[model samples]
Target: MEGERAGMKIGINTWAWVAPLTDEELARLAPRIKAWGFDAVELPIQAPGDWDPTVAAELLAGLDLAPAVCAGLLPEHDLLADDEQVVRLTEDFVRHCLRAASQVGADVVAGPLYAPAGRTWLLDADARRATTARLVDRLRPLAAEAAERGVTIALEPLNRFETSLLNTVEQALEVVDGIDGLGLALDTFHLNIEERDLPAAIRTAGDRLAHVQVCGNDRGVPGGDHLDWRAMLAALADIDYAGQLSIESFTAPALAVPMSVWRPLATGPDALAVEGLAFLRGLSAVPSAKNSRS
Candidate 1:
């Protein structure tokens, strides 16, 4: 944080250590996260009761660590599905997360909200268009809800394997085009897979980019794998996006197979967090165009 671009903050997700983070886990991990020099802690809301927002708010405020909120959508939370009940359920969950974020003093709730992860299917051009219309309609009201609570819905686009719709910045932009309270949350892992040029995609997102998630191309430690970290940071600088670069690698045992995380990225979660923080901090000391401008 010493030499970071003005207004830019770095964060790490609780998912990097645990899934469905509880208030107890947050209390335990937050001190270490602050000690490691993270500006914020990205908290996950896998369900409404996964954590207590009031407790989290107090703990974070006490440690001087900012709070961010991310969400996990199950198959039942698909907004584009044919079932009205399913759409209603999804809306309820998202609203709960937005309220939780507001309670925890987080300005944004970031995640793939249109459809559940791992829900993919074939779609003809005509069907795809129809689905897009449905998505926009469904999300408009939620965007309004987020705005009312002073929270932005940072919609994320997953890879082809995770979801069929909204796989690129262009697609996501289209959905959020006329929506005021909706913005994009780009993850480097998904960008590496779906984007032909990562930096260009970041530039395209521009001011609408609300949140950012970083990890190695292989879903490991940020700087321990093959990714152009400097270029990515530079593109962020070009956009003047003063958002948090939250690390979002997953390590929960139950998530290994579903997430396809077959190999260990570090000796343990602590090592991964510490190493990634060190590498990113080192970037701040290196002279670059962004640093020169600063």
Candidate 2:
């Protein structure tokens, strides 16, 4: 039953259906997600106006569902930038996001919180290390603040094209090492693109992993396409990553965020969440059944 609880824990990222969700819609959606057998839901904190975390907490708690928060800071919100005001504003946002996560009962807050997504520039080796050092210094205070609220801040690495700073687990680990309350966040979509060996990368992340986000290679439903889900889950198990494996894919036919992730996946928004939960459940059962028979 211990393993059952760990393996059965699956979450859905709400941004895939953000277009169709208002505050009232989210209130309705929480119960529906619980009905679909999800253990939790992930809400993105882009700005103060993105969503109401207090209301979301009531809804999720009512349904006995867990919540996780993802940061959505922009380039102007850069913590490593030369501008002091930018760093201050970015820290404020991080603090707000952390408070929101606490209110929503989130155990972890994950995203590219070190710097802004889609903001990239070429950096020499020395400059990269310096930038990472700055990121650590800026994030340390915020990480401590989050720790007080019992929330782990997971730092994510985007693809090389998206950001030149941290493109792999090794880079993220180096950037986050010795940070008291920080951990790594892995996204399968980014993993499929950047990792030379996906399972090996997961193993590398190991105990440092604070959160996991799953989607197909094309950023769709987990099992609707050709991803090695078994291998990935096995690696997660090997690492003892006792965190929410949330499904995170964006909606298509309309570009919302400026990240340029416009790929059209085969599954619709609602179907993606429903099917992905089923797929994770199947994956979780296989090892437990084997262990039982053995």
Candidate 3:
């Protein structure tokens, strides 16, 4: 609510430029993002040594830009793991991520925090319910910690093949219901892959949605392909979900992540951020002009 713009606020995910970016590089890039009319920047706290949040905070403040923190959970970060040590380490890492997010002045710390990305397996009904229960138990404390830091923990749902746990907004809500300091972070990429109807699914998330990530079906610059972005934005408006619609995509040849996620997203990542900003702004402007006329 604090940083709402006329249209949906557009932002960029640093993962697009992660391989080539250092702390100083992001400092330089933050202002460029702000100048391009982006409302905020989503920084990935992929691992412990990826980037320094102190410097990131200073850079964002200097540019008068807002921040959103994305936590990257690896295979070892399993809340449902039988090993107590594994669960302890994962919870500790999540706490650190929340601290880093607060330090950077991010509104919310969003990611697939329920389990490690790409760590998937088959689950029976009882086992799946147990996993959901474990996730709730694991996240409740983290959610409290986030609230203490004045931030929210946004639980992102991945595709079916990626995780055995919650993979849709409806399922995410069911798991997070009555849990303090937890909300849904919807990604259009996942929605496009899994949802029966994109806009209808978005409306279902409704008031419980905390954050949004947008990209083309092929993970390219939005609007260059065939996504009904206008309808998407209109659905968001109908729900009064005033939050940043950050562009999240990965670049290839780096392979810093797992092999499954290393595929090329677009022709190039160089101009996707700027181009996406322009596209969303254009779509948002149309509604404003029409509203003025009426």
What residue pairs are clashing in model 2? Answer: none
Q: Give the distance in Å from residue 86's predicted Cα in candidate 3 to where it truly belongs.
A: 0.1
Model 2 lDDT vs. the true structure?
0.79
For residues 122-192, write the lDDT of model 1, one tens digit per residue.
Answer: 88899888888889999999999999999999999999999888899999998988798999999999999
TM-score of 2: 0.91
Candidate lDDT values, in order: 0.87, 0.79, 0.78
Best by lDDT: 1
Query: How far out, in Å, is residue 273 in model 3?
Result: 1.3
lDDT of 1: 0.87
82: Cα error in model 3, Å: 0.9
Query: By TM-score, highest first, what's the ranking?
Result: 1, 2, 3
TM-scores for all predictions: 0.95, 0.91, 0.90
Ten residues in sequence with the least summed lDDT for candidate 3: 284-293
lDDT of 3 by residue, 108-224 (tens): 888888678778888888887887887788788888888888888888998886776778888898777787678889988889888888888888887778889989887778888
Question: What are the per-model numbers of colliding residue pairs?
Answer: 0, 0, 0
Instruction: Give the C-alpha lDDT of model 3.
Output: 0.78
Q: In what order do the candidates fall by lDDT, top score first?
A: 1, 2, 3
Instruction: Give the alpha carbon lDDT tens digit for every residue of 1-294 in model 2.
Output: 232445536888777776434577687678888888888888877677667878888888889888888876766788887889988998888888888889888978899986777878989999888888888888889889988999888999888777888889999998677776788999998888899998899889978888999998878888877777877776776666678889988873344456466555645778888877777777643352224456
Q: Which stretches of candidate 1 lie over 4 Å from their true place?
A: 1-3, 284-294
